[model samples]
Target: MEEKYRVLADTAVLAGEIMLKAGAETFRVEDTIRRILRTSGFEHCEAFVVTTGIMITLESSKAGTISLNRRVSSKSTNLGVIDQVNTISRQFCQGELDLSETFQQLKNLTPVRYPEWLTYLCMVLTAAFFTLILGGGPAECFVSAFNGLYFMISRILNRRLHLNDFVFNMFASFFMAFTCIAIQTLILPELLAEPAIAGSIMALLPGLAMTNGIRDTLEGDYMSGAARIIEAFVIAASLALGIGVGMECCRLLLQALV
Candidate 1:
């Protein structure tokens, strides 16, 4: 009975950790964990979730108490993984999957990602189309495609540097703006710099984070919602700061050249 309790604890914690890391909302994570624990016939199952961690406690007359805590340090926006976790938990709760089988499935679950080439291609297309949507000409669309390299460069540098999200995004946007301004000044003077910069930086915007923050807030997850909103704001500020610095530097250099 003790061993079974331990296994259930492990499974519930693992599911909560994965969902939290994959950007699931606070209430959702807590609810999932609670449901998973309830299946074990625990008299009391409590799940506490925040943006940064998860804590679950299960109490039964036979097993006494089993408690688990999982800290989540890194997170990314992956709605698919969140959905997968939800599905698995639902299955476990519905008796479609045994506890051990559910645990195995969660353990093996991985986020679905597009190939690098395809991802990059989509990035470029996204920038180009955004440029058009914002009333930019063909030249702007062309330049925005190159500016879309921001994602590629950031990914490469982040793999080696492991900087936090704000710093990483600031540096990437700095590089992007600098290059875009230089191209406009030195080679593509006829192209509008604003659209290209605007379009490319769209990729860096924390839209999903902001949206989730609002949703969480509406759902009464105030702490988690506030944290996510603050995160989105920080990223936006970093992007603005990087672009401002890059543009000022480019303008001064051009003045010197003239």
Candidate 2:
């Protein structure tokens, strides 16, 4: 019985960790952990979740107590994984799955990712449309598409190199800004750099992060909310810094040429 309780606590904490790292709301994460533990017969279960950490404890007169702490250093958006975990938890609670089966399911779960070509195509379309919406002409839109393509490639390479979010965003933004300026200066002198840069850089913005931060704050997860907000700010600042540096360097190059 004690061994079973230990497994339950560990599995519940693991589920919460995965959800938290997948960018789920803090309240939702806590609720999920609590529900899992309660369903597993741990009536005195406690789960505390933040954007970067998870803590869970289960206490029972018969089983003593079990506790765990997991620090999450990286996060990404994976709704599919979140949904799968939620389903597993629901099934377990309904007695459709035993503890061993639940553990196996969670252990074997995999995140779904879009195809590379599809992702690239979507990025191109996003940049092109954003450029048009920002009052750029068809020529500028075309240029922005190429910039977006390169930006996507840079992001993929950064991820492959295992760079952090801030570094990856900075690198991608620098590449985007430099390419936009170079294209405007050399290939399409008529191309407006402002709209092209703005449109392409939109792809690198921390929109989801900012939104989640606000949501967490409103839900009373103040610490997690503040951390996410600060993260978003840092990421945005890095992107701006990269863009500024790239533009300044391009300006200097143009001046030297003239």
Candidate 3:
């Protein structure tokens, strides 16, 4: 009986952690945790979730009480994991899944992402099209695409190095700005920096973060919403700082050359 209760609590907390780290809204995360606990035969279950943490408590007259808290340090957008967890939870609720089976499924679930080459190609196209949309000529579009390639490489490196989002974005933006300015000055002197920089930087914006923040706020998860909003702003500020530093360095280099 004690082992069963422990498994239930562990499984519930694991599901919540997965959902939270995968960028699910806070209310949705809390609901999922509650449902899992309730379906597992714990009627007096409580779950509290925020952007960076999760707390769950389960109690029964016979089984005493069990509580778990998880601090989520890193977060990323992986809708695939979120959907898989949701499906498992629904199946559990409907009696299609047992606790052991559900636990194994969650443990075995792997996040799916686009292939690296395909992702790079898509980013390149995105940068190129954005440049063209912003009144850039064909040459500028090509330059922007080239810069996007470098951005993709930097992103991959940052991921491998386990850098934080703010540091990664700052460095990636700096690399983009520096590369664009150098290419413009040396290879295509006529290339406009504004369009290339703007278009390339568009690929680095935290659009999903901001959207999730607003959604969480509207759902009444005010604490999580505020945290996500601040996170998005911090990332944006880092990108801007990197761009500013890169531009200033380039200006100084040009002045020295002349």
Give the per-residue lDDT of model 2 (tens digit) for 110-161: 8878998898888899989999999899888887898876767777687679
Candidate 3 residue spans exceeding 4 A from truth: 187-189
Candidate order, TM-score descending:
1, 2, 3
Candidate whose lDDT is highest: 1
After superposition, candidate 1 runs with Cα above 4 Å error: none
Q: lDDT score of model 2?
A: 0.85
Q: How well does each candidate superpose onto the true structure, as a TM-score?
A: 0.95, 0.94, 0.93
**Number of the top candidate by TM-score?**
1
Angstrom error at residue 80, model 3: 1.2
Give candidate 2 regions above 4 Å deviation: none
lDDT of 3 by residue, 1-258 (tens): 888878888898899999988988888888888888886576589999988888889888877899888999888889998999999989988889999999999888888788888989988999999999998999889888988877787778886898888888888778778877888887888988899888888878988888889998999888888988998899999999999888788877977997
lDDT of each: 0.88, 0.85, 0.87
Clashing pairs in 2: none
Whole-structure CA lDDT of model 1:
0.88
